[model samples]
Target: MFREQLARDAARIQNQFDLVLGGLDDLDVTQAMAYTTQGGKRLRGFLVLESARLHDVAEDQAIWPATGIEALHAYSLVHDDLPCMDDDDLRRGKPTIHMKWDQATAVLAGDALQTLAFELCTRPEVGVAEVRAGLALTLAQASGAQGMVLGQALDIAAESAAEPLNLDEITRLQAGKTGALIEWSACAGARLAQADTTPLRQYAQALGLAFQIADDILDVEGDAQKAGKRLQKDADAGKATFVSLLGLDAAKLRAADLIEQGCAALETYGSRADTLKEAARFVIARDS
Candidate 1:
């Protein structure tokens, strides 16, 4: 049931993307934006929708931010796969944007998608002006210098640093790299309703960390075909990851513990939050 709901939500958000992007000029950059956003778990969007459901926000109103988060995520992935970054040739079981098009097109597509995210977030359907402004503000913070970019910069620095990052350093790094957007997505519903976001914030913090740990585990032991991208890059690069810093078994244990903590944080919502708890489990269990 959880997986089914995830698929349904993914379809919904993808449709939203189609509606928005379909109207744009059919340039290569626009094409790349659509292509890059085409497939994924759509986990971040799911968080927005699920949290909105828990808060009794209508799906019509909730979907704007849901789609917004996904656009932002797609932008990040496109940039991350560029020649200057991870330099990956594949993503989501297909060629990266830079491979399909050119580096310039990929860069432009990423930039356009980043701006489109804010446009979607600020749409009048989302809420009152304050809610829209708040969503946009938090998104900028989550994806900008203080958040994912900072994490990426840290990662690049670590690769050339004299020493490999320790577990604590990696934890802080992943909190920004992976956790920031997840936290924002989970809390968006509360922000929409102007409700306190402490519980969802806690839930996403744990879930995001667990998600990164699971990614490290997948990097160590996962099929590249199933993962839809290159795996074991961290190991090849000699970079420190959860699976490298701690043994694989220990890293798995840590992820499980984090999942438990994430689920526990949703106890205030009882059965309404079961899907999110299942999502936390899926994060570790998924191959991609």
Candidate 2:
């Protein structure tokens, strides 16, 4: 059910993205923007739709923000793969934006994508004026200096520091880098429905941390081909990840515990949230 729903959501969001991005300039930067946004798990978008459904929101009303979050995620990936950043050449089994185009074009594409995310969020189809405004504002908060950018800055600083980060520090960094967006995506339905966000917020907090822990574990055990990007980067860079700090077995155990807690957090929704429960388990089970 999880796999089926994920695939369906991904396809639906992609079509929405295509429409949202239609009639842009014919330049390479815009082209690169489209290219960089294609082919990924679209997990954040899936969370948006699923959470909205859990709140009894219609799919049509939910898809705008789903597409918006995906654009924001894609922008982050584009910049993360830059020559000065992680400097990777591959993403989602294709050449990254900077590698496929010039660095300037890549930068422009990423900037354009970020702005497009805000534009999508403000679309009438997302919800009422209040929901649209809230989505845009929260997206800025999640992606700005205090959130994802802060995490990325810390990660870059860690590379130059004499000592690797400890578990607690890494956890803080991962919460900003990964958990914030996941939290926003998970809580969006509540924001849309004007329902209480506490339960889903709790679920996402655990799930986000587990997802990062699983990424660290997969770096040690995953196939590079299947993972669709470079693996073992932290090990090669002498960075401290969950797997490095706690050992692979311990990291796996920790991730399992997190998934359990995440599932348990959804108990308030009963069977309606079973798919979300499966998503928590799948976070640990997936290779990519």
Candidate 3:
């Protein structure tokens, strides 16, 4: 039942994204856009919609806000696949945006998507003016120089450094790189629903940490075919990861603990938060 619901929700968001992209026609831009947006589990958008539902917001009413989060996620994926970053050629079982098109086109496509995310958030039909503005600001801060960008910088630096970081340093790196966006997704959902943010923020924090830990676990054990990119990239790059620093079993245990905390954070919301709780479970259990 949960998987079916998730699939339906994903289709709805994909349709919304298609509608949003209908206004653009430049071949290169559209190609780059399609390459990045075409696939993925759409977990971030699901969180947005589900969190909103938990707070009594209708799914239709939440579509634009959810799309905004997905756009930011797509933008990040495009840049992360660039030669300067992960140097990945494949994503979602197909060529990455940078690989499908020229690097410059991919860069511009990412930039456009990032800007479009804010545009979608600020659209009058989707949210109130203040909510839109606040969501836009939150996304920018999460994706900007002080957040994900800074994390990427540290990751690149760590890859080249003579001394490798220990577990604490690696956790900090993953928190910024992966955790920032996950936190943003949850926070954006709660904000859009007009829910009290204190507990939501706590849930987002724990969920983000759990998500990264699971990602690291997948990197260690998942097949490249399933992952849609090279497995063990962290090991190849000599970057510190949870599995690399704490070992596989310990990392798995930590992920479980984080997921528990994440679900616990939402306890005050009761069964209305079942979707978010299930989402936290999915984060740890996902193979991709």
Candidate 4:
């Protein structure tokens, strides 16, 4: 059930991307934006749609934020893959933006995509002016210096730090780097409906940590081809990860526990949240 819904949502999101990008000029940066945003689990966008469904929000209204998040996520990846960042050459089984184009084009494309997220959020289809403003404000917080950027800065600093980051520090960092966006995606439906977001927030806290832990596990054991990116980069860089701190077995156990906790948080919605529970399980069980 979850897989089917996920696939359907992925297609829907991609179509929306095509529609959005089709209006842009045929420039290198625009083309790069189109290219980079293509293909992925689309999990964030799916969370937006699903959470919207749970809240009885209309899909038409929810899709704007769903598309917006994907655009923002793509921008992050494009920048992250630049020579000055993670320096990767591959993403989603394709060459990284910087590798495919150049650093300048990649930078511009990422910049454009980032702004595009705000544009989508503020579109009339999303909601009233207040809701749009709220979405944009929260999104800025989630993706900016206070959240994802702060986490990225800490990660870069850790590369040269005298001591490796302890478990708590890593946890704190991941909460910003990864969990912030996931939390935003999960909570977007409630924001759209102007409903309470406590349940989804709690659920996403566990889910995001588990997702990162699962990524750590994958870096150790996952297929690079399936993951569509370089694996074991952390190990090569001597970075600490959940697998490194907790050991592989313990890491897996912790991820399982997190999934359980995430699922438990959705008990208020009962069967309406089964797909989200399945998503929590899939996060750990997935190889990529």
**Candidate 4 — which residues are off by over 4 angstroms?**
none
Q: 1 or 3: which has the higher lDDT? A: 1
lDDT of 4: 0.94
Model 2: how far is 42 from its true place, Å? 0.8
Clashing pairs in 1: none
Model 2 CA deviation exceeding 4 Å by range:
none
> For residues 110-166, could you state the per-residue lDDT of candidate 1 as single tens digits?
999999999999999999999999999999999888999989989999999999999
Task: After superposing candidate 1 on the true structure, give the runs of residues whose Cα lies further than 4 Å from its correct spot.
Answer: none
Scored against the true structure, residue 34 in model 2 reaches a CA lDDT of 80
Model 2, residue 185: C-alpha shift (Å): 0.7
| Native-to-model Cα distance after best TM-score fit, residue 131 in candidate 4, in Å | 1.2
Q: Which 10 consecutive residues of model 4 have the lowest summed lDDT?
A: 92-101
Q: What lDDT is obtained when candidate 1 is compared to the true structure?
A: 0.94
Poorest lDDT segment (10 consecutive residues) of candidate 3: 186-195
Comparing candidate 2 with candidate 4, which one achieves the higher TM-score? 4
**TM-scores of the models, in the given order?**
0.99, 0.98, 0.96, 0.99
Candidates 1 and 2, the one with greater TM-score? 1
Spell out the clash pairs found in candidate 3: none
Q: Candidate 3: list runs displaced more than 4 Å.
A: none
